[model samples]
Target: MKKHSKIIIFILVLSYLLSGTAFSADIPDDSNVEIVSDEVSAERYARCYDERNYEREFAPGQVFITLKSTTPIVEDYGVLFSEVDVDYVKVISEKFIVIHLVEKTRDSVIDAIDELKDSEYVKFAEPNYRVYSGEAVVPNDEDYNLMNTWHLQITEADEAWNYSTGSSDVTVGVIDSGVSPVADLVANIDYERGINFLDETEPPIDIYNHGTPVAGIIGAVGNNGIGISGVCWNATIVPLKIYDTTNREYYVTGIVEGLIAATAMNLDIVNISYSSLTGDGMLEAIQNYNGLVVVSAGNNNTDLNYNTFYPAALSDECDNMIVVGGSTPYDYRYDLTEQGSNYGDCEVHLFAPGAWIYTTCADGSYRFMTGTSFAAPMVTGAAALVLSYHPDYTTAQVKEAILNSVDQVNALTDLCITGGRLNVKNALLYTPISCGDLNYDWRISNVDVIALARYLENVLELTEHQLSMADMNGDSVVDNTDLDLLAMMVV
Candidate 1:
């Protein structure tokens, strides 16, 4: 999913009554968003297909409503359907339902949803939004070889595998078109749990080809004399297809449904290799998710500091989210005139090798692809590897481990918050030290106290990672409170 190519609803939240808990969300209504596209590059990146309008929109006449636990669905809530002029009611989950109003116009749907949301029986109501994958297609010319995969070598995933090759217990949900049963990927997928949210009756298959490489990048089998190795040599990939066959794109409602499915399926991480404008529903859903949600920084080549992009841009509010941008083999951001990686010192989290990436195609073959879409899975695989080694680690620990240990590069200094490329080994072996531990040692002592005092007084300089460690109370600052905490710990 390049820049505006693919739009993904926040697939982190969408759970209703999993383990008998409350419900929350992410979704869209086309009228609420403006699909920003790089007109010059939109055609340039449309390699596999003809150029088409990639404007974002939602499925018409569809309204997603969450029923309060007390409101049973036995009689369609009695008068609620008739009051809102609902044409039909479809069950999305135990507590979620899709209501189709008789009038299919945008105004009618929004107006009807507004009424439904005010009802005490309804917890929330939102429009069903749509998204698409904007990928840059290239010919199947490159002969992919596992050992020669530079993405693996550069990220040091090859070395990380030496310690742990990922775990079967950890599951990664790929929310995209879908993932085909390719040779390198078949053995790593959990077929029973995979589903097509766009059309629940059908199996989730990669008919559009965008998700295959993303999944392959995360967990393609290694040492099998196969095409390419994923970040994790061993892991489970759950195909959660949100593509709308009717429109040849993704429905925000479908992606939100996919997120719920992921939560119910107990997935540890979800990879959304796409971008779109933020939606209220998607934002709330991602915030409620308990696991890590990795997203692409989009391929618009715009600075996210000024522009707004969904899921990725919501990283500040969602702790579990890790937004990624694209980098190149030359150790520089893949910034092109019309299309490239979206960069921001605030919104975007880090960079990954997304250009000229060779991975699996939807047709069970291999090809070279580009976009922030491919960059996300590298981090997904790294997160899976960390979990495979330390299954007990929480999302915060996992995120900190990855963010605090990037391979700092000169070229990435100002592009993103963490101006460095991913280092799989560093992340896999990372164990975040205590906040007061100035030295690498786990203990806080007089030596640490001196370092902190000097740094606070401007007599010394601390790396970004150390500065985080010194902020004892997690208030995003190092002041008197932190000093007190450090002193108490040292004593």
Candidate 2:
């Protein structure tokens, strides 16, 4: 044989022994949770029984009284109405008793409901707002149209929906200020349950359009195709209003109860774009809970290099939750994003376009808003698309696909741990990263040649998959040709 040809043969043989496959643990069995998208526009806002529409769908800001049970009884409205002033009492549904309270207070309403502890009747009483704190607030029309100070790019909205139309049954819990059902942006929303923890009543009227706009960004119904599309156009959004604008206090217990309810409902994702430092219990509950919870990094622009803000960006002990930071449209650092965006060598996870995101609002209107609040639902919507296809993926796995497969950013590597922004297009392209380097230093000795021979002959135990890095020829398979080529090149 010619000297070069012999060298080629020798190199090819040596290459086969060096290439090896790297694999992570396979997906766990219980990870296949399906996305619920078929019921996107079902009787989302109808009365519990689907019988008739109430005069006006209850909004988050409105106050009310909820009786303990659904049984027909005209007892003295005294126990329920004594502590707080009663505006009007009406039976909106069989199971829910409505009391229009004059005062929306925790002490007053809880005291009124507490008085009934001995009565064997009224179940629970609370104020309600459609939006909760830690939930994303949708910016209004002018705000939406304003140039995003973060310089984040708004890709054609349709590009996202092309991947997966969205799962109808998957419920996205909007825990922000509150939302109004009449907004065209969220016109097709499915309100599974509304709680007015503010005044302890049934009707939840959104005083602020914050929650409504966030809801539009995550799950605005599509193909009706009238308004801008949400990340998950076909999913159900459970509006949980838990904020009080008066004192700027968001009840932590209300958040805990919201997550507790979402846990019971088996919601696929909870979008909390709002945050405060006070709610550790609620944050812990969300972290500890088994379902998927996506939270904003926070809007506070303080230095976060030392410590993270709250609930959404909590530690990995609650692995099912994803903490998202905000990115500008251009994928550069945005000062508007909470300075607390980065974590100290911890998983602050992914970033999304949150500067001045535009979406639907209450009262059949549209608007724009900024904050990490808007950024989170973008990930939630993308995760919904992935879950729709890979329903078997656990919350952790889904989070992995998203966090691992994000589009790498330019200068923000220190800001974002994954070093990328959330890109659905890139996420679906992910395969496990490989680590094998079989052909790196292998010599063309007789024994090494024999190992290669055995590997190809199937005599020695060889991994079924091989690293592409070792595939010198660029073909996917790593074999004798690669080994011989490497040996000859060196010899």
Candidate 3:
């Protein structure tokens, strides 16, 4: 009886399909057609559809599709799209095609994709998703000038200055367009030699006006009273130009060569404000170098947990790399930074001020720019400060100090790995505690014993490194037994 009932229900469903009376929810309102698919393919299609926040439709009557095929598509393949009601098709690449739909079928992008996927010649089919710059915030910093740099005040750069303004020995490689010899930049320091991989010159030129500001943020001379101060006042700036003005784009070969040049120079910090889908030779160069590479998390305002971006996405593969996201001055009170900044709990390591940043321009002037591009140099400058203080510190130790010293903020939770923003003062003040130096004075003494006892009694707070040092017995706990051993060592 149950089998008979099931057969009857199936017949009723088949009747609805044959009659074309039952409408499919999968069919969009504008398009009356639906693509039939297996359950697994349907779920995959739905997931992909939900991932994009489509602001608007593509150009009318046109859609882009990427296809993988078992056999090379012949010149006669134009007939394939004609069968699906697509009038014209252009081959973008061996794997990419642009379909021009007839006016009536313009809105049936999904239907066309479904039809193409069902073909035996095609292995897979998907839309060519559009990508945008992640930068969004544009707050005016006119009220706060060089005398009172608001970003410096918020990050407590003054307090950090008490420890170290920056060392001339620390060199920062600005891996962007190129640096300019603007009066504010050149008057204080000579034009340091740098490589222009785009044009193959000794001193890179700033034609596009992007790299100058990034360089200014990293190491513009401070206290000259003429213009703004940078994070590191005395650090050397090396311009490794990779952006090509002719094409108005950054090629992978130029980027790879720029990284190789920077690595060869053994720069203390390499600041990359841009991102690419592929890392290629860049990741290997960074790994081979002894210094740290600070990269922007990109200003796309998307969740990187699922959508991977390069260099920033390669954080796990390279320990010397730090992926930074953008935050606003109001991030502490309210996360009012640019909405376009890309973030991931695992991919992005930290956040810094990126909106309306006032820095050097190409024409010996200053202006405000916004992007993860601007935000990356802040952390790069901070790393420079750390290196200036401890020039001998290993790449891992320097990275540790910067990561551990961030100012914890509730607003950045789950957006970055550190769950905090850059705090230059805290980072500069942080001195990695040696195994037995519980007091963190760079030496083992009776004071360490006293401090350890207070910590055990819950009267004092201990930093992570301090707590590790307090575990004198090497059992990974700060217990009374460890306290006894600490007292013995003190004696």
Q: Which predicted model would earn the best lDDT?
A: 1
Q: Please estimate how well model 3 matches the true structure, expressed as its whole-model Cα lDDT.
A: 0.68
| TM-score-superior candidate, 1 or 3 | 1
N/CA/C clash count, model 3: 3
Query: Candidate 1 lDDT, tens digit per residue, 1-491?
Result: 12121111111111211222000112222243222222232222222121111111457788878889988667564366666887878877769888887888777766786577668778877777653232211112233333236567667676676667888889999999989999988999887899988777888889898999999999988767757778887898999999887889775666678778887877899999878875546776776678899999999989999998876777766768898999876567887677999999887888988876778998988876778999999999999999888787777667867887888878898888777889898887776545565553335666666666666667667766567877876668887556656665544
Clashes of each: 15, 71, 3
lDDT string, candidate 3, 1-491, tens digits = 13353245335433433464011112113132122222232332231122222222245555576566565677855676565766777888888777777753434665666677767656665554444332222213332343235466556665677656788888888888888898667642334558877667456879899999998888777776667778887888888888888889987677667678777777778888888877766778767877888999987788788887777877776768888888765553122354578887778888887766778999878876778888889999999988887776666556767887887767798888888888887776565434455533334566666666666657667767567766755666678766655555443
Candidate 2's error at 43, in angstroms? 45
**CA lDDT of each prediction against the hidden true structure:** 0.74, 0.55, 0.68
Q: How close is candidate 3 to the true structure, as a TM-score?
A: 0.59
- Candidate 2 Cα outliers beyond 4 Å, as residue runs: 1-157, 183-188, 245-248, 336-347, 428-491
Runs off by more than 4 Å, candidate 3:
1-148, 187-192, 332-339, 433-491
lDDT of 2 at 203: 52
Q: CA lDDT of 300 in candidate 2?
A: 68
Worst 10 residues of 1 by lDDT: 5-14
Tell me the tens digit of each residue's lDDT in model 2 across 132-159.
2322223232322213212112322334
